[model samples]
Target: MNDETAYKVLTGTEFAALEAGRFEGAPVDLADGYIHLSTAAQLTGTVDRHFSGQNGLVVVTVDLAALGEAVRWEISRGGQKFPHLYGRLRMAAVTAHAPLARAADGSVELP
Candidate 1:
């Protein structure tokens, strides 16, 4: 949950793509020209707003330091600074990954 790490929520298919070695991101990311990432605080909202009622989702922990200049913190979603990756995501940059889990209040559980 520290600033050193960011989270990428991916569908099962997208995760499979990443496991293959690299990930270009999802449709929205492709359209936006960057991979969308959320902080621990923003994660639940991102999941609730985008992946509600869906299953088989996974949360990938990204090492922001590894991304270096590829990560840009931009104002987004209620004026908060969100991390966006401007290049392809390689498996080497992923610190950890696990299936998405929700709390009793339906909030996303950080991996």
Candidate 2:
């Protein structure tokens, strides 16, 4: 993935809805109130290839801190506990202006 598409930001409620229906049975991680979602298929494909096959899935992490109070409320409704929204969200690839990089500490660092 390129810089413009490397990161995708979604509201908690939106992610919750997507997770409840579409991403059922996918692996999820919640840490520091943030939700990280990944699917086995996505992890094994292009996204995984871009990430050096690290997780074998396309992972999307939603930061709770980035959500508004109303969004959180909506996401938690109906006794539906929220899980990390992870999956292979497919999109058209675009040409990148510059290359992406990783820091010495192994964190992705963009130019």
Q: Per-residue lDDT tens digits of candidate 1, residues 1-111?
A: 476899999999999999997578899999999999999889999998999989999999999999899999999999899999999898899898999998899888877
Q: Show pairs that collide, candidate 2.
A: 37-86, 42-57, 42-58, 43-56, 43-57, 43-58, 44-56
TM-score for each model: 0.95, 0.21
- lDDT per residue as tens, model 2, 1-111: 111123322234433545455422223223334333222222223233334634322234333323323122213323433333232332221112123344586544321
The C-alpha RMSD of each candidate to the native structure, in angstroms, is 1.2, 12.7
Runs with alpha carbons beyond 4 Å of true place in candidate 2: 1-21, 29-53, 59-101, 109-111
Model 2 accuracy (lDDT, Cα): 0.31
Q: Model 1: number of clashes?
A: 0
Best by TM-score: 1
Residue 75, candidate 2: Cα error in Å is 16
